[model samples]
Target: MSKQRPNLYYTELDLFILLSKIGLRRKLKPSERRVLVKVYYSEYATPVVPVLITNGKIRLCGDYKLTLNNNLIVDEHSLSTSEELFNGLAEGDKFTKIDLRNAYLNWKVRDEDQHLLTFNTHKGHYNSTRLMFDLNGPPAKWQRKIENILKGIPGVYYL
Candidate 1:
């Protein structure tokens, strides 16, 4: 049989614990609960996927496909084609590459929308405060955000 590859994700800790302190749990305070959106009932929460250890750190994520991916209205931001990428460029154009580390974490989910990102684990319930990679719309959302910010800047292109 082939290996059972899970989209692998989860671990839990006390509310707002640092990455160094995973696997610990504590009850959320009222104010902290305001921001975290704790799922009191597992019925409303999606199961956390699987867990992996990378660079001696724990990485937790969810399989949103089993939950939010289908129902969500995907952002319809179309991508540029190869021809479009080259359209504004000239011969011998110097190129530079810039990558934003932890780029998804830069965008916060709207206050009303955070609960849509919530997931449940054996340990507890939780939600993302910022955009996560597994969500269906972030690529388009991020692309649109970048495009909006870079609109008037000259000589800049994104794929």
Candidate 2:
């Protein structure tokens, strides 16, 4: 007999803890809730998929194919730009990377404004009650949330 593969799942409790870190509970609508679930499932299903949410933006994890269409998510110039940014940062004398606790969840999403960042998944499409970044498109409104988080942090850079 063939062994069955593990059906990894994100329990409601697991999602609760994750969403709580971002303070996003009670904010997601039915559709948005469904979408977030789908993301977790898809990512888990494909270990090769890149998973990154850095600087409150979804940083390029790997070359991804947009589920909206089969279009490749990377362009040559963008990859080069990403490489340059990494190379420049690597040359820095000192580096301190700070990752917030559930960064995106820290911001609140109003009921009326949840539809703007909506996205669809193979399971279904849903809007985010919280913010999501589009590295290729204009910054989302939650950019301010990151700004505020950074402001509260004390830092000094001298040339």
Candidate 3:
């Protein structure tokens, strides 16, 4: 019988690519960015160690276990939407569509409830908890805002 073993060695770039592939990538705060890069470089041969420390987890394939809450927020596009809602079909109408850049990022999740956005890694688990939106139930204010917008539409509309 013959026995074979797999090689687990990795290069610096390999670690970077691995982290990126699993969605473990993050846009660090201005100050944290420098530190993060240094941490990655300083521990190049064993980047995973620092990665687990800095990110507080060892994610695999970038899949994070997201726990949805009742106070969830979601993009309008994610909801059941109709093209006619914003389509300017009237004759001689100048249609204008504005995209909200990084709209979800503009939202702030309360510090107390940030733990909802966490992931389990190969080593342990970590989370930012600062959710930009909810995927489950929604806030009352958001529901009212949508309802108000729909009610205020001057023409016939259906969702």
- Estimated TM-score for each candidate: 0.64, 0.29, 0.38
Q: How accurate is candidate 2 locally (lDDT)?
A: 0.36
CA-lDDT, candidates in order: 0.62, 0.36, 0.37
Error of 3 at 135 (Å): 3.8
Listed per model in order, the count of residue pairs whose N, CA or C atoms clash below 3 Å is 2, 2, 7
- For residues 36-95, write the lDDT of model 2, one tens digit per residue: 433321221211122336567322111112322132133322122556546556656767
| Regions more than 4 Å wrong, model 3 | 1-17, 20-27, 31-66, 69-83, 86-88, 120-126, 132-159
Q: Candidate 2, residue 81: CA error in Å?
A: 18
Question: Which lDDT tens digits does candidate 1 get at residues 85-158?
Answer: 78866543698867853586557788766766777665567766777657777778777888889788888877
Q: Report the number of the highest-lDDT candidate.
A: 1
Clash list (residue pairs), candidate 1 = 9-50, 10-50
Q: Model 2, residue 69: what's the lDDT?
A: 14
Query: Which digits, one per residue and each the tens of the lDDT, describe model 3 over residues 1-159?
Result: 012221222335655566665545664566433222221111101113223435566532212212233233433423335665545244435454444332433345565544444333232334343333323333334544555666756543323
TM-score, cand. 2 = 0.29
Task: Give the best candidate by TM-score.
Answer: 1
In candidate 2, stretches whose alpha carbon ends up further than 4 angstroms from where it belongs are 1-97, 100-105, 135-159
